[model samples]
Target: MTPTPIAEPLFRPEDAVPMSTDEADVLAWPVAAEQLATLAKYWLATGRASGRPHVMPVMGVWLGSTLTVSSRPGTVKGRNLLRDGRCVVTATTELGDLVLEGDAGRVTDVARQREAAAAFVAKYDWRFGLRDGRAYDDSLPGSPEYAFFEIVPVKGFGYGPDGLTATRWRF
Candidate 1:
């Protein structure tokens, strides 16, 4: 994706941290979709209706420019998403820190959930089955079922390692 350059300066010279101008200018948005698909984990941030923020480690796949994640209905992350669909998912890689902000909605379509289940199995080595249109970790008996979610990014910022430049992508 060719990012629309970040309008606001990502950092200032006087800021406690410092970086050179060339390093800042070189921080461009990644154009390769394969790079995004290679991510293993992302920090998924969710909020309650009251605006309380909660973040946690989550394993998911970048499928078709969207991140697909699953959590048990009883978990805090699942409850927060159910309460409020908006969220931000951030991940760190050798390239930089990528933050994707969007709305997270439950995946209710059986066909889509099946794809997600297979992705989970392929990525995490967990065989999840779909029942009632949600994925369940079938490896354990009496295991709680997972509620799958899809977050198609509305906006994202890739904070370069130099900390002076940020590449912004808008969808």
Candidate 2:
């Protein structure tokens, strides 16, 4: 049987730009280092609507080009992504902040999912016992309930006390 196409947000190739190291420095300069650190925290919020866009903190990792995060089998965020296929993730340090808005999608490729999981473990090994024999692949393959998302940041913003500065990066 043919696999059904998963719903996803619309993304244009022209929108996939790369942010340079120089640009990162420039954008992250104005904010205080401590503030920037705090902003680098997990789970901010993403959605449209005037008041309070359901800020949910989530574990994330900066893989240079894109930020990857995993959610449990069932959750509001997972359900939201499955329905909308779009999200925004934000991280900030006392010195600066970064916001990524883009078309979010699940990583269906087994190898790619494993790689993303490994990267997440490496980034958060100190906080979570990721290598304590708990393998991510232990679960059955193609489990409809299992959810993992790879956020391809299309538009990004870096801001600080100085002013509104921004940078764009490829997912």
Query: TM-score winner among the candidates?
Result: 1
Model 1 deviation from the true structure expressed as Cα RMSD, one decimal place:
3.5
lDDT per residue, candidate 1, 1-171, as tens digits? 433434333445575255443443644444424556777778899986677899999989866767888889779999999888899988887777777788988989888888888887788887887776667777788866988899878877677676756655656
Model 2 has an lDDT value of 0.51
Query: Which parts of model 1 are misplaced by more than 4 Å?
Result: 1-33
Quote the RMSD, in angstroms, for model 2.
Answer: 11.0
Can you tell me which runs of candidate 2 are displaced by over 4 Å?
Answer: 1-40, 44-52, 126-146, 163-171
Per-candidate TM-score against the hidden true structure:
0.81, 0.58
Error of model 1, residue 115, in angstroms: 0.9
> Which window of ten consecutive residues has the lowest lDDT sum in model 2?
1-10
Ten contiguous residues minimizing lDDT sum, candidate 1: 2-11
